[model samples]
Target: MEAVFLIIALALVLMVFAPVAPSDRARTPLRLRLARQLHLWDRYVYHDPQIWYPRD
Candidate 1:
């Protein structure tokens, strides 16, 4: 049926565009993870936007 074909087509499109999972080697250590999170929070979340923009 047309409905079945449409569902299959949508599933195929989503499969092609889905994000791949990070590999084990891509995982960061705990200290680095915490540091990155804190840095982002400080720069973006807790900052005074009128005085600062994010650096590259």
Candidate 2:
């Protein structure tokens, strides 16, 4: 039981501290990706306006 708890704690720490890539093509850590998807980190995450609203 203790070992399982330790493993879970370690995984949580790793996920929280994992690095995120700035570019869309680059891979982002799961935690950060989820935050972005939920709009929790929108200020910190970059969104290219061109991608969302392209001028005709």
Candidate 3:
């Protein structure tokens, strides 16, 4: 009975603290990659000093 209780307790501890393995699925899809490029020009404009002067 004590052995069974210890086993259950150990399993509960592992379940609570174990890190989940990441899935084999891709994080970003092809559609999202294409959509991200659409904002590339806007990103460059915002970050470029030539387009917008940075106040130091």
Candidate 4:
């Protein structure tokens, strides 16, 4: 149970920093479907980080 919670928490953290924002170019039906699922998952289970982490 603890491991499951940790994995879920990690995914939520990653969602907050989604590497790319899907836009018009990603609007094709297939991509749209994928994006929709991801967005919904983010909405339900995501948590924004308390601090932004710098990237290279």
Candidate 2 per-residue C-alpha lDDT over 9-44 given as tens digits, one digit per residue, 9 for 90 to 100: 576566566665566666866766656544633542
lDDT per residue as tens, model 1, 1-56: 79976875575556444544466555556566556555764675457765456556
lDDT of 1 at 39: 70
lDDT, candidates in the order shown: 0.58, 0.60, 0.58, 0.60
Per-residue lDDT of model 4, residues 2-56, tens digit only: 9987886687566555645456455345456556656876765455443244354
Strongest candidate by lDDT: 2
TM-score of each predicted structure versus truth = 0.38, 0.37, 0.34, 0.36
> Residue 30 of candidate 4: its Cα lDDT?
49
Best by TM-score: 1
Global local distance difference test of model 1: 0.58
Clashes of 3: 0
Q: Which of the two candidates, 2 or 3, achieves a greater TM-score against the reference?
A: 2
Worst 10 residues of 1 by lDDT: 12-21
Candidate 1 regions off by >4 Å? 1-21, 24-26, 50-56
Give the Å error, residue 20, model 2: 2.7
Query: How big is the positional error of residue 28 in model 2, measured in Å on the Cα after superposition?
Result: 12
* Candidate 3 lDDT tens digits, 1-56: 79976875576555444444457854565455445543664576578997577677
Residue range with the least summed lDDT across 10 consecutive positions in model 2: 37-46
Against the true structure, what is every candidate's RMSD?
14.6, 14.4, 20.4, 11.4
